[model samples]
Target: MYYHWIDTEKPAWAVTEIRERSRRAWNSLFAEERREKAEAEEKAEQERELKEYYAEQHRFFEEMGKKNREEARRMEEQERQRKEAREAERQRKKERARQAKATEEAGDGKGKYPRWTQ
Candidate 1:
């Protein structure tokens, strides 16, 4: 027995013509018995690959997050050091000014250089 399937490439043939070929595309690739098995296997393989890929991305993202956190911490420490250095510079300048004022006052004292009484 043979069945007629809509095959534009092959056109319509007699029942005997279809049977003589021995292999009907519909029977081999589209039969209810075999179709589900092939489709299910292909679907399962694709789904497994997709799941593995997502897992890989998650791991990669976790690693990146750790690296980013470490980088942020390092940058924060550097900024703190820079602020401390700036504060030390200001303190040194203030000390230098105070020393200059004291030296001027001391030099103005004595018989040769006496302080003016006001």
Candidate 2:
């Protein structure tokens, strides 16, 4: 029997022909289902790749954060050292001023002369 493509809504003339064609259509549908399944799997794989990429970025930022903390600590130490040095210098200047004033207040006398002069 000749099959007409335009009238696919009607069944084929023979029962055997109808069954065979139905089986073929079912097989095609199954193939389409498998293709869709594969596409979904591929999409899932792509999402996983993106997730991994972000995770790596997160790790990199964490490392940078540690480095930043170290740098801040070093800067604090340097600041502390500078403040201590300045404080010591200030104390030394004050001590020198006090000693000079005391010398000026004390009058020079022949009795205060060195033992060699005596």
Best by TM-score: 2
Per-candidate Cα lDDT values, in order, are 0.83, 0.87
lDDT score, candidate 1, position 88: 100
lDDT of 2 by residue, 1-118 (tens): 9976875465446767879899999999999999999999999999999999999999999999999999999999999999999999999999988876676566364466533334
Model 1 lDDT per residue over 1-118, tens place: 9988777475457656887666675566568767788899999999999999999999999999999999999999999999999999999999988887777676656666545432
Q: Where is model 2 more than 4 Å wrong at Cα?
A: 1-27, 107-118
Cα deviation in Å at residue 92, candidate 1? 1.3
Model 1: lDDT of residue 23: 67
What's model 2's overall lDDT? Answer: 0.87
